[model samples]
Target: MLPLIDGKVVDITGPGRTDRFGVTCTDLGASIIAPNGKLVSVFGDTFSGRRVGQGDWRSPVVLIGMGDANHEIVYEYAGGSDPAYARQLWDYIHDDAASGWRRGGISTVIPSDLLRVGGSLYLHAIVNHGFGDVIWTEIWRSDDSGVSWTHLGEQAKFPADLHDGFAQCWSWDFDPDDGWVYVVATGFQRDKGIILMRVRPDQIGQRSQYSSWGFTDGRWQWGQQATPITPPDEHWGELTLRRTAPGKWVLGGFLASSYALGYRVVSSPVANMYTTPVQTPIVGSSGSQVAQLYGGYLLPGSRFGVTGGVGVVVSQWRTDTGWPYRAMQFKAKLKDTSKTPRTPDPVNL
Candidate 1:
């Protein structure tokens, strides 16, 4: 299922202030695709390292994944506050993969999407407190892989019958046919475009077992509530939604008024997400003439066995000069019209 060819942008974090690892600009740079395939990125504020116009807001929180044996682990968040004023968890190590990554020893959890399943690892976080008030999304459970974590507090919220305030929890996967674990949230002022829940990889931390994904009358039910499988003009922001092969699935994100980086493969993520997808253009959109994209993660080994190429790990918001939120790496190629024919909208549930 590797097809995505639009290839060219390769900068894998660097230039946001000479970058070496002190990431600049900041944004939810979630990524995951390890287990030997490599590509673990995770970021959300590194502006203190300076370079996006000089730096001063030290709210460090970065990690690059793959430690313990495969080596190459670059963690950060050495207790400088801002996990909502310190939830404790410090680890700042940097062996010079570029003078920019540190923070690897302590973590109260801030990762967003890390999946492992069977042997257990799962992260998919958000539990905030650092200035945004107190966001939610939570779900942490390590068996020993990520060292230690157990907070399984809030798994899915913000469905106040369909929306009333906040929600966060973007990107998730683990649908071996139907075993569950779908996720892909939105709301928190995103206007409302994406939604779909699932849960059952052993009750993913049990939020009453999780369900959502309803539509009524036209069909496609589940528990009968959640909607917008992405259509309200599609304003989703930092997304990922996996499953690239057995029935395809895709999703990808960043379309807040055409800021570019779009995608939508669908064969079933509950099918029909309003078709008409496949739009690149990052680096600040306007058709990405180059320079201003933002977190478009898609690497999980590109999904299904080798077939063409498809890596994605975008976030080039450097804005003015040379380093602001750097972390680029592209290798697209899946455009044979992406296969076309997606029809399935009337499920009998």
Candidate 2:
């Protein structure tokens, strides 16, 4: 991984309409180490340096992955002119004569997290736009450090029939401890709400079928069955996991709703699969990236949590009493996750 100077703001322009898929900072004040033992740093590009939601143009989707300590992988998904963007990425990571890598579908594979397991590097991508409109969680692997790819296929069950809409899955992570991968997704069969599912690494590149929904509404509560954490209904995007203390893993992200947008936290038994999620106050939005610190640890002496990506704060519009918290600039006091309470106590003290 490249060592970016602390507090250094670099500009990378000229990538026609860039859509940043995710951002991750490695060094979390010594909690999580960078990919290769070096301190982790920030590496993300905006559309011509414009803020995330300000520009009218759609940016290129970028996903960051770690492959060993020396190399940081940045994967982009562009379904325009190139047509073979995914294939190009495959070629870049693998050698020739390779029959297409293992992937679920072909439209858009925007990876949420890139992980290395048992000498092979696997990518967790949210299949946004494909031949079918449905969205899905897809996995792609490279045994030789971004050399040749073996499209392991969709990380979830392959439907009997393909749908048109994107298979909008929230986010996913891998658990080395249990050897399983967990994902949170919404079934298009329904209008709204989310359904979470758990899969294994061996299930990659292969297809499975599910008769009914994978999760229930009460499943996201804290200290209940299925990992025992209650996730907020706010627009909580994808999830990323890391080991903070011994045998303890924390899930981080922003809970985005029509009323409020802020960071969230939950502890889990397995590494990436989140069964139950308890909401915390690390409130704020991180655009495409959630509340994950790249190195996979919280900040040193930092009571509050650290949020990545285009940090934007919106007021809570929907509450029990219908009180609205207007969107505001959170640049100054954003990192104060320590001050946040376990429940929805947005007193702003």
Candidate 3:
């Protein structure tokens, strides 16, 4: 049974989108397990395409909820400089000082991004903006659940450097093996496109010392400099990294054309390393991030006409800007073709 919150029972089968309340900002966080045997999802809300200045970026807060049903478990924000909005959502719609965290009024402020690592939570937020444009990547942890927060570093600590020196990190996932945290960023130096980076989960708020990877030169290279993965004319749908075989890894992301975006698979000696993304022949459209859970099972993603694996499911969607504002799901059977070629082009031609 799905959980309920605030006396409201959320029905997953019910239609999503409860009336466009201020354009549901894009959210990012980790796929995690909760204390109550439930999967926990953490994310932040921000504008779709516009920045904070274009309109008032109000009600700065970080949200936590049950992963399957979207039942909001906790809504966290700062008291003074970073305000919490759940205490007032419907009634205090646009009230600024009603919760705190707004300085130059609500119209000029935007909060930071949030990430979870090891067993703790971290946040990187924008403090003040202007000629120099200062920002901070602050750290916070909740040992007893999301009831209280302990602020860990200085405010506006690492200006314009953490998320590609100006780019904001939109999606992030962590690998407990090497303590490396990966973040997928959209805006860098203001206008650069999508890029990927690797950081130590322990380095949050320390310095912006993450490694950058590029899908260029017919391969991937590490640098402080990076090139966009999705080319100009083409659109990238979704990206996911999952462990399919024991010690065997898969890095998959989808692309959309007028016809279809098929299942493409690429293997690397290391989980995140890829010379170039090899496209497979299975044709479909609008792909999604894949999660490998419970002994070689694909947890979420779909390719029609594909079947036969126990405990597998997929999430498909129609997206605007290659970023899925809304997602639809499909139940699929994952097949093992390890003995066969992943691509028809042949392994090493």
Candidate 4:
């Protein structure tokens, strides 16, 4: 397996407008692999016929998937009116690549991390009533894929007070070893560090069943008070956590201030989550210069049965480029630190 080094990060979407489909100014592109081996992705705040950072088109969410020819829209949640005014309306979008994206049944909440465990599909999303006003993290379940959904109620919320500053739960993954869904969350202020939480797969809908990771008396423990697993100075935006291979876990996200995509590796889910990570520059002037890049997440499936190296999807905004909110794919190689004495220094690609 090739080690992840400072190399060129390419824009897979290519050049021009037709190459860019769906809504503009869309971000937080979270993805999940379907049973049919298709890479299905869900995006937040999509604007139809608009450029990145442009005025809102009132599209709250949109779904797309990788097809044999190209990426096609799977579904889109466009209300009769602006989503800001019709905050109470909850809808669903279905995945039908054969006929293109079609409207599906309705639900009470929007979706973030779309995960499937056993026969049921789980959706993790921010519960917002006002425009850009986040309420809390809500979980929903669907038995017949994305056709229908049932609200599972609030899975987590920011504390009434800002003592811990833990607010929105962003990304998650299921761990087969313990049958738990581990979640990574951060604050709404965008300055607080990241926090970790987990719930049993069966008890995912119950708020009380969820537990936070805590470090007390020089030991790591769950079910205690929540604390920042990352450094106090670093603020994380959208994040993804998943098992790349047996006993190998990878966490990836964008540094809010730097706008640089970075990742951390560990032997197990609960092991050394707080340690500093090796960063690769994706989109910044001093960094990789990919420009306006955010929401860097590892794709669900592996390529060629090689878990050491995988594909990562990052959102390239219109900050520098004229095009806003384009999804770009990059190749990432995970390094085996067991053979090395210490974690390698950050590399600027």
Pick out the ten consecutive residues of candidate 2 with the lowest summed lDDT.
23-32
Residue ranges of candidate 1 with Cα displaced over 4 Å: 1-24, 29-45, 52-92, 97-179, 182-199, 203-239, 242-250, 253-260, 265-277, 281-294, 297-314, 317-322, 326-349
Q: For each predicted model, how many residue pairs clash, with residues at least 3 apart or on different chains?
A: 34, 57, 8, 1
Better of 1 and 4 by lDDT: 4
Best candidate per lDDT, number? 4
Give all candidates' CA lDDT scores.
Answer: 0.54, 0.32, 0.36, 0.56
What TM-score, over all chains together, does every model reach?
0.33, 0.45, 0.48, 0.72
Q: Encode model 1's per-residue lDDT on 1-349: one tens digit a residue.
A: 2224454444544443224344544545565544434334555545545455355333224343432211222343221233222222234232222334234322222445667666565666554433222345556665644434566655433232333332464678887877887887774344557778787898877777778887878776788677777666667667787786777777766776677777776666776666546555333223555457656777655532232255666666655664546655565544533457655444641
lDDT of 3 by residue, 1-349 (tens): 2221111221111023311223233332223333433333332233333322223333333333333322222222322222333221111233234457344432222333334554565444333343224443334554433334565566325445554543442344565655676654443222343466777766654545667765454656776466554445433333334443343343333333312222323233222322334343322223622322101112222222243221111222223342332122123233333333433433224
Among all candidates shown, the one with the greatest TM-score = 4
**lDDT tens string, model 2, 221-249?**
32222221233343343333433333444
Report the lDDT of model 1 for residue 78: 22
Error of 4 at 161 (Å): 5.9
Clash-forming residue pairs, model 3: 78-82, 81-101, 112-125, 136-156, 160-165, 167-187, 301-314, 301-315
In TM-score terms, candidate 4 sits at: 0.72
lDDT-based ranking: 4, 1, 3, 2
